[model samples]
Target: MKTYTDTGKKDTRSGFGAGLTALGQTNPDVVALCADLTGSLKMDEFKANHPERFFQVGIAEANMMGLAAGMTIGGKIPFTGTFANFSTGRVYDQIRQSIAYSHKNVKICASHAGLTLGEDGATHQILEDIGLMKMLPGMTVINTCDFNQTKAATMAIAQHHGPVYLRFGRPKVPNFTPEDQNFEIGKAVQLQEGSDVTIVATGHLVWEALEAAKALNEESISAEVINIHTIKPLDTDAIVKSVKKTGCIVTAEEHNFLGGLGESVARELALHHPTPQEFVATNDTFGESGTPAQLMDKYGLNAAAIAAKAKKVMGRK
Candidate 1:
């Protein structure tokens, strides 16, 4: 079994800020907009350095979407930053009509996504953002795993045309991936290889999946771990190839099981290769006001939960 070390703990939102700062220097056409939550989204550096390129749209998230779409017409790459709940659910109509329908080159960078938003409660936490964004035509949905991966994804989206939904979280997680890694949209990163079971994870669950793989190894279970950063345009080929070797699979994510990564993987598997699978995600429920750790444990979204699911799925095989 392969081992991964956490160099340090850092919030994924900070990675976005760092990436945005870098973009301000290199990408001349890149512009940023924030809907009142500038600091929360970690766009302070970008806003400070590129004041002329940054727009504070106040609390009007829907209006921000429209403005971003308009800017895209002028050939400016606009990255709109806000909470996931406000970014997607609050302005779905504007995004669908203006961005997706027209294929605008707007990057909707959402922070404080999923249950990791913590004490902000269910109203602020948007677990269904990935599902909502992925359903739209020409919309690329990416849920990055760690700080390094999030930073890489932030920079990568600028080069890609069409609308994009980039989701990250508030809680600091293990910084496991390479700092200078290239972020490829719709590409799955294979963390570890095995033949007993495949553990596919996205967002905050990627690190947990790695930890789960280690636990599974102690029990003599060889678990293949894959980090699925991009939800839409999912790497079906990678999933199919891994499942063919393992015969069973387990998916982990911070979003609800209904429309999250697990459902997407299940669809692909059902079409190409049927495999026994278990999901480690919120079971169609809203999160409450609590610490991130507490929320993760209560909702069974941690390493222990992932390991147990892997074991259960392997049993069905």
Candidate 2:
């Protein structure tokens, strides 16, 4: 297994902010719009440096989406920043009608996503944003795992011409991925190679999946690990190739099992591979107020949970 060292802990949203700041210096066409949560989304640097290009929509998420779409028409690559719930669920109609439907070059940059949004509770934690955005025709959904990858994805989406939903979180987690790495859309990063079972994970659960792989290794279980950052344009070839080698699969994510990465992997396996699969995700239920660690433990979204699920699926194989 390839080893990954934790350089430091940083929130993925900071990565998005840094990426946007870099784009502000280089990309003249890249403009930003925020729904009155610039600090929470970590977009202060970009806004301060390029006030002319930054639009503060004042808590109007739907209006922000419409504004971003309109800016795209004027040949500007607009990035709209807000919480996950407001980014998709609250303003989905505007996105669908104005952005996705028209294939506008708008980047819906969502922060504070999933259970890790912490004490904000179910009302704020938007686990289904991935599903909501992915279902939109012509929408590119990306859920990055760490700071480096999030930054890379943010920059990469600016180059791609289409509507994109980029999801990140507020909690500071392990920044393990390389600082200088190429970000490829619809490409899976293979973390480790094994023969017993395959563990495919995305977003915050990806680091947990890697930790689980290490634990499984101690028990003599050869577990392959793959980091699936892009959920919508899923890297099916990498998933299928790994599953074909292992014959069983374990999918981990921070979202509900109903419409998240687990379901996408399940559908792919059912169609092409028919491998035994186990899902390490939130059951179909809303989250409650708590610290990020507490919520992760209670909802079975941690390393131990992933390892347990891996062992259970390996038994079926």
Those runs of model 2 whose alpha carbons end farther than 4 Å from true positions after fitting are none
User: What are the per-residue Cα lDDT tens digits for candidate 2 across 30-70?
Assistant: 99999999998888999999999999999899889988999
187-239: candidate 1 lDDT, tens digit per residue: 99999999999999999999999999999999999999999999999999999
Q: How close is candidate 1 to the true structure, as a TM-score?
A: 0.99
lDDT of the candidates, in the order given: 0.94, 0.93
User: In candidate 2, how many Å is residue 91 off?
Assistant: 0.5
Where is model 2 poorest over a 10-residue stretch in terms of lDDT?
264-273
Assess every candidate by TM-score: 0.99, 0.99
Query: What value of lDDT does candidate 1 attain over all alpha carbons?
Result: 0.94
Residue pairs with backbone atoms closer than 3 Å in model 1 (clashes)? none
- Please give the TM-score that candidate 2 achieves against the real structure: 0.99
